[model samples]
Target: RPGKEPEVDLPYYHPRAPSAEVEMTAYVLLAALKTEPAPSQEELSFSSLIAKWISSQQNPNGGFSSTQDTVVALQALSQYGAVTYAKSGAASKVTLRSGGEFQQDFQVDATNRLLLQRVPLPQVPGEYSTEVSGEGCVYLQTSLRYNVQPMQEDAPFTLHVSTIPETCADSKAHKVFDIGINVSYTGERNGSNMVIVDVKMLSGFIPLKSSVRKLERHPIIERTELSTNHVLVYLEK
Candidate 1:
C-alpha cells in the first residue's frame, strides 16, 4: 500500500506546435527569386521580393504577425531600403520606420571596466520595452501590437526581441555593440489581449573573440558525382 498508490488519470494536454508559416514563406520567396528575372544583373534585389511578400501579409492596422513568420518577414524586409515594392495605384513609397536612432556612449574607468552610457529611447506606437543590468550581464525587453485588432491599453502582453552588436572591424577595432526589437505575444487567459504598441529596448555587450572558427562545415562535392549520370540516380535512389 505504501509503495503502490492508486493510479489516477491525469488530463492529457499538448502544447501548441511551432508555426511553419515563416519557413514556408521564406522558401516560397527564395523560389520566386530564382524563377523571376531581374531587370538587370546589377539590379538584382531581394528586398523587392521580400517587400512584396510582406505587403501581402500585413494586417489592416500596419502590424505583422507575432510568430516566426513576422520575424522572417521583418528580417528580409530590413535587408532592403525603406521600400520594397511599388504598385500602379498604391503609394509609390514604402517606408519602414522603427523609430529614432539608438544612441550609446562608451567609456573606460581606472579599473579598466567598460562603462556604457545608454540614452533612453522614447516610446513609439506599436512597440514594447525591456531592460536588464548586472555585473558583466545585460537584459532585453520589447513590445509589439497586434495590427489585426485594437487592444485595450491596460492589457498585459510581451514581445519578441534579440540583441546584436554593430561591428567595428572596418575601423580596426575588435568589437562593436548593438540590439534589436521585434513583435511577440504573451498573456494568460482573462488577463489581457493588448499588444504594447511602443518602443522597447534590451541591453547587452559584444565580447571580443581572438580566434574565430567556423561553426558549420561545408560538404565537399566530388568531381565524379558532378561528371556522372550516377548523380541523378544517386539523388533519386
Candidate 2:
C-alpha cells in the first residue's frame, strides 16, 4: 500500500488514539529515502509529510511514547545522517604516534587508496596523539559488522516481566529456592499467533525439572535444557 501512492494519510478511529506505530513506520520510510543514492520523484514527494509526522511524535524530552517506536525512529534518522552527509573524496594524510615509540603514516590519494585498513601495533601504554592534515576528511571511527551472527528477534508485542525477589540470595551451599515470575504481553494480535519465549540463565543456575508451568494460560510446549542453560516456552496468541 505504501509504494502504490506517493503520500499516505493516517486514519484514526478516535481522536484521542495514539499513532506511534504509523508515525514510526513513516519515519523509517523517510529515512530510507534520505539515504538513497538517488531518490525518485515519488520518494521526494513524501518528504514534507514524513518530516512533519515524525517531528509531531517527538516528546519534549526528544523521545517517543513507546521504546520500540523510539528505537526504530532513531535508527532511521541516524542512517540518514550517516549516508547523506558522508565526507567528500579528496587528498588526505593521517599521522599517529604513541609517546614517540610507535609511529604510522597513512596517505589517501588516487593511486594509493583504500576503503578499509588494518594497522597492527604492539601493546603499549602511553598517551597517543593523531594529526590529520590534507584537503579531505579522515575518518578514524570503525564500523563493526556481525554478518554471521543472527539478528536479534523482537517480541511480536510488548512484554512486561517482573520477578518476586528483587535481589538474589548470596549463598553457595546448594541453595534451593522458589521464584515467581510474571510476564504480560501488551501487543494486539490474533488468537492464532504463536509466541515463543526464550530464557537463558547465567552460569551456576539450573532450572528445576518440571518446574515451569503456566498458572493462568495454557502453553503449547515448554522445555528446558540445563546443559545449554536455556528454557523455551511456546504459547498461542
Against the reference, the lDDT scores of all candidates come to 0.37, 0.55
**What's the TM-score of every candidate structure?**
0.21, 0.30
lDDT of 2 by residue, 1-237 (tens): 233332433332112114456455656665557644676656644653564456555654556667777776666654444434435566778887787578888887654553645475554334667788877434463212223545697664555554334445545324544444445565455444665677665467766655664322444444323335666666654
> For residues 129-214, what per-residue lDDT tens digits would candidate 1 score against the true structure?
33323232221212233334445574344456454534555553334433344443344565433222332222233222221111
- Model 2 residue 109 CA deviation (Å) reads 11
lDDT winner among the candidates? 2
What root-mean-square deviation over C-alphas does model 1 reach? Answer: 28.6
Deviation from native of the Cα of residue 187 in model 2, angstroms: 2.8
User: What does each candidate score in C-alpha RMSD?
Assistant: 28.6, 17.2
Name the lDDT value of residue 130 in candidate 1: 32
